[model samples]
Target: MENDPQAQEEILEELVMALKAGGQSFILGILLTSILWGIATAQIWHYYRVYRDDSKSLKRFVFLLLLFNLAQFITIIYGAYYWLITCRLPGNYPKVLDVTK
Candidate 1:
């Protein structure tokens, strides 16, 4: 495909249109995950404060679980931002998807 600006613009517009439903689903999933992560964070804090005598092994397990959730949450937020903001720019998503095919 030649680097025709009009064709590129058309591709971008088409890509955005195709993404709408999937985008809505992504937003919904992000919202639900965010709420659950928040609640889990709060509960973990409470566990640390109130369960001072929890066996060391159990405390380690809780800490590990929290770490896992934190990592997942960060990735989800980053992915949402990357796809919705960065990739939505005029040139980005088309190249990423190799839309020429």
Candidate 2:
């Protein structure tokens, strides 16, 4: 079964069908997300630079902390996406098997 060409062909066919169904939407979503992420990153950098030169230490510290939090949040979101879509199977299968049978 491990070397079954028919099974491999069937899987490829199914993958093709699935891609045909939602491939465009998937690509568009990633593109939109990337654009928005870029814009957000740029804005964060701009704000950080603007605040970095502030004369008031308190304002600088608060802005730095806020920027750090924003960065961490963005990183968490990216990590989640990576974990969900990249690191695992395309579909959400049960991670554990019921071996009682």
Candidate 3:
């Protein structure tokens, strides 16, 4: 059976409404992820500081891990902002999704 454009539009509208409905939850998720990332990075830094004189290689590894985690944190923050903007601004939704199709 062929898909009807009208049905597809209806489905899309419903999906958008659902996303809008969950806007608060999305914000909460973003907040929680950021808080958890901060806590993890803090713990890593604490360990690194405590064991700074343990080994040269271990220090380097911990430094690298911290850098990687920092990069990941930045990426996640950007993604969360993008998601929030996309979901909160319904006017751009069609244009954003249109590019995929």
- Please provide TM-scores, in order, for all candidate models, with all chains considered together: 0.79, 0.43, 0.59
Q: Candidate 3 — what's its lDDT?
A: 0.69
- Candidate 1 lDDT over 20-66, as tens digits, reads 74578779989999999999999999999999998999999999999
Ten contiguous residues with the weakest lDDT in model 1: 92-101
Candidate 3's residue-wise lDDT over 24-100, tens digit each? 67578778877887888888879877876778887788778878877877886677677667544646555545543
Candidate 1 local lDDT, residue 74? 92
The lDDT of each candidate is: 0.82, 0.56, 0.69
Q: What's model 1's overall lDDT?
A: 0.82
Kindly provide the TM-score of model 3 when superposed on the true structure, using C-alpha atoms. Answer: 0.59
Q: Model 2 reaches what TM-score against the true structure? A: 0.43
lDDT score for residue 60 of model 2: 66
Candidate 2, 25-60: lDDT as tens digits: 655665776676667668767876786766677666
Local error of candidate 3 at residue 72 (angstroms): 1.5
Q: Which rank order by TM-score, best down to worst?
A: 1, 3, 2
